[model samples]
Target chain A: MKIAFYIFSSLVFVALQTTIFRELTFIGVAPQICLVLVVVAGMLSGKEWGAICGAGMGLLYDIVSGRIVGLNAILFMYIGFFVGVLCKGFFKHKRIVVLFFTAAAELTYSILYYFFAFFIWGQMNIIYVFSKIIVPELLYTTVVAVPIYVLMEKINDYIERKTF
Target chain B: MRYIFEHKIAVLIISLTIVFLVFMASYTSDKARANLGKDGLSTMVLPFQIVFTSVTHNVQDFFAHFGDLEAAGKRIEELETQVAVLENNSRELEDTKLENERLSSLVGIKDSLKSNDSIAAQIIAKDVSNWYTVFTINKGSGDGIADKQAVITTKGLVGYVSEVGAKWAKVTTIINDGTAVGGLVVRTQDVAIVEGEFELQKDLLCKMTYISKGANIVTGDSIETSGLGGIYPKGILIGIIRDVKPETQTVSQNAIIEPAVNFEKVSEVLVLK
Candidate 1:
């Protein structure tokens, strides 16, 4: 049941990200809802679930919207794993913690993505990319992550109650 | 062995990452790699994208019409004055058209794009990544659209189809870092390569490079496709120069171009067959 739910939700999120959310840009950057989902899944469950959810979402996104295959898959998987492992002992329900982790994950993802996609391709303008793209996206994704986390928490609670 | 047993998830994650890294490496190195996964995924998602895109457009049009009502009177007044001006200009244009037709027959000049077949397609979605300026259109190989085909709007050049599936195609726009087109300056007749840069994409602009050092190119100069590359037909308007940067130590002089098509508002395009 959990697997089915995750797969269904991932499909919906990927659809939204590519179509509606693609138009909903704040300062030319869309909120990374899939990233938020991975972070929330990690925080709610554990490393294994987080990594699984991340890989699933990343693979869906890459197959659907990404130009290069498996790029987002690897980035998202590690983000999920690290967030899960690091936030293990913390009060996972805290909004501030979710926000912080989302921001950190977004930053890490953006930097790593930039390094692979642009930096090695001779686009050596980190300052400009940071100012123009990364920061705005980070703030936007972080702010958007809160509501997504809340919603996911509700779903997780419902699933847990049903399971046990 | 104890540490590995204790951190099984970490090891698993590392192994998966390495596997994906290999996939990425192979995918990049081989352009002709099997795209069964991509094609299957795209085909499945294309219907939902079309539905969502249509709904969004309808909603936008609804609000846009409501807004238009408030400005309708003012717009009518302005349009009335413009109509009168356009009427006079149309008469002059008719004479010019007749003269051009006569001169063209004498010169044996041929119209390029008008002679080719074209398919109209609606844009279903923009690229999900913030780094690239790509968009997916509803038409694809099934509709006679293919990779590297020129895409345009009534205004002018949009870009070219970079990838195609059965029912959808991805277009890499002129502002994307991956696109390059042969451009000719109409005023100076100077030919150069127009290319998209990562930084310039933020402003919906591109750069025309490889101009001769002594070439007299300036701001506001019109640029069109040069027909140097067979991909884009000759004489389609590409853009107008917005700024000219002088030659520097490591780079040649280049002019920034404001593309003829406004990508932000473009919803439908024609794919030249």
Candidate 2:
């Protein structure tokens, strides 16, 4: 059932990202839902489940994006692993960690993305991309972290009812 | 070896290595990327994109029309005051178009154009990442849509087809990175190349480069497709010049543009066949 729920939310979030969220942009930036799921799931479900959910969702997201496959999956797996370890046991009912995890995820993704994608593509404007894309997108994603974290907490609780 | 597999960190590293290898393979192989879209997943999900886009579009339109009615009320009052002058100006403009065509004949450039064949396509999805601008449409080869065909809304030029599937296609807009559209400043008749830059797209703006030094382009001047590129039709509205950027002084000038089409609200487009 947890696996089934994961698949269902993955599809729903991907659909939301490509449609309504496009219009729900702030400062010309939209929240990265896949990244949000990674951070939130890690905080809620602990190391193993969070990493598993992140990998599954990330792969689906990569396919929907139609870009380099598994790029997001790798980032998400590590993000889920680290966040899951960082807040493994003490994270229950702690919502503020959502903001911290999201910030860390955003910063990491931005730097790695700028390095691997933009710089490798011959765009040597790191400072420009850092200031313009990274900062603004971080703020955008952080603002969305609260609502997503709250929702994922409920889903996590539902999944936790049946013991492993 | 058994203990290594039992360690969580070891398992994580193994997963990371596998995904990274797949990523590298897909990055290096064009066939891998093609297989992604052409494979079974996209076909199964295509119907959901259509349905979700339709529902969202309707809800958006419902709210949009409310705003439009309010704006329309104000326009009605303003137009009532200016209706007389606008009627006189319209008559004079029609008369000038006729004389302008006659003069254009001597220059070997016909300012006339016939209607283009087109098909209406519903927007199915927006780009997953905001870093790039790409969208999916419901019509494709079945509707005679092909790569590089221009997509436009009633307001003006939107984008062109970058990729096509049997029943779906991807349209990369001018606001997307690396896209370019040749533009003409209506006020001065000066031609310029409009290109998308990441810095400018942050503000939902594009950069119109290669502006002639002698051209008298000002802020708010309407820019239209120059038709120099055969991809988009001639004289389709591209945008309005917003401001001049002082960078790149060694070459021609560059100006910021606010595209005529409101991309966020665009639900459907007519694709030139």
Candidate 3:
């Protein structure tokens, strides 16, 4: 049942990212709400579920994007699994930790993406890319990540309560 | 081996990672490697995207009316001035049309774009990642749209169709880093390659490279498709030169172009067949 819900939500998130959020740009960057969802899944469940959820969401995004497939799936799977494992201790359930991890994951994702997508293609303007693309998207994603995290927490809690 | 057996989650993660990496390698090597997954996923998501896009448009239009009231007087004055200029231009255009018909009859040149058919498609969704400037349209192979077809707005060239599915096609806009178009400066007739640069894409601009040092191109010089590239048809307006960067040691002189079609606001496009 949980897996089914994750699959359904993944579809909605992919749709939203490509449509509504695509139109709503902050500093010419959109908030990566899908990444936030992956983080939330890891925090709520465990490493296994987190990685599974991330892989699912990333595959959907890759298919929709029509780019090289499976790149996002692998990156997001690691991010989800590590976040779940690292936050297992005292950091678990803390909103501040979610913000920190979300920012870190976004930074890592942006850098790796730039390296693969642009840098390898001989666009080595890291400073310009960092200032213009990476930083703005990071800040925007970080700010929006909190609210999405909170919302996901509420939903997970509701699901737990209903299941029990 | 015992540890791997005990740690089922770890095994799963490692296995999935390997599978994904392998899949990525294969897909990269063969772009035409059956797109069944992509086609299936796109078909499922297309309806939702259409709904969301329409809702967003409606909301924007609703708010635009409020803003329109404040700008009404200014717009009317602007329109009045435009009407006067258009009337003058229309008279000149009529004479030019007569002259063009005579010249074309003498030369026996046929306009290819006018003879070809085109299909109108609405943008259903944009690229999920900020790194690429691609968009999905509602019409695809099912509607007679095919790969490498030129997409254009009434204003000017938007880009070309990069990938096509049954009912959807992805457009790689001229601002995307992967796109290159053959451009000709209308005034100087100097031909060059217009490419989408990473830095300029953020500002919705492209650059015309391979320009000779002696090229007489200037700011506001109009660019059109040279028809040298097999993809985009000839004589379609690409953009106007915003600025020119002088040649450096390793790089040739290039001019920054502001595309005629505002990518952000373009909702519908015609796919030239």
Looking at chain B only, the TM-scores across the models are 0.86, 0.77, 0.91
Candidate 3: share of reference interface contacts reproduced: 0.74
Those runs of model 1 whose alpha carbons end farther than 4 Å from true positions after fitting are: B1-15, B29-34, B84-106, B248-252
Number of backbone collisions per candidate? 0, 0, 0
> Regarding TM-score, does 1 or 2 come out ahead?
1
Top model number, DockQ: 3
lDDT, model 3, position B20: 86
lDDT of 1 by residue, B20-104 (tens): 8887877763242227777887777777778888888888898899889979999999999999999999999999999988999
i-RMSD of all predictions = 1.8, 2.5, 1.3
True contacts kept of each: 0.67, 0.41, 0.74
DockQ of each: 0.68, 0.48, 0.76
- Report, for every candidate in turn, its global Cα lDDT versus the true structure: 0.86, 0.79, 0.88
- What's the TM-score of every candidate structure? 0.91, 0.82, 0.94
What are the runs in model 2 whose C-alpha is more than 4 Å off? Answer: A122-132, A159-164, B1-16, B25-39, B43-71, B74-115, B186-189, B245-249
Docking class of 2: acceptable
lDDT of 1 by residue, A51-83 (tens): 989987888788776467789998898888889
* Candidate number of the best TM-score: 3
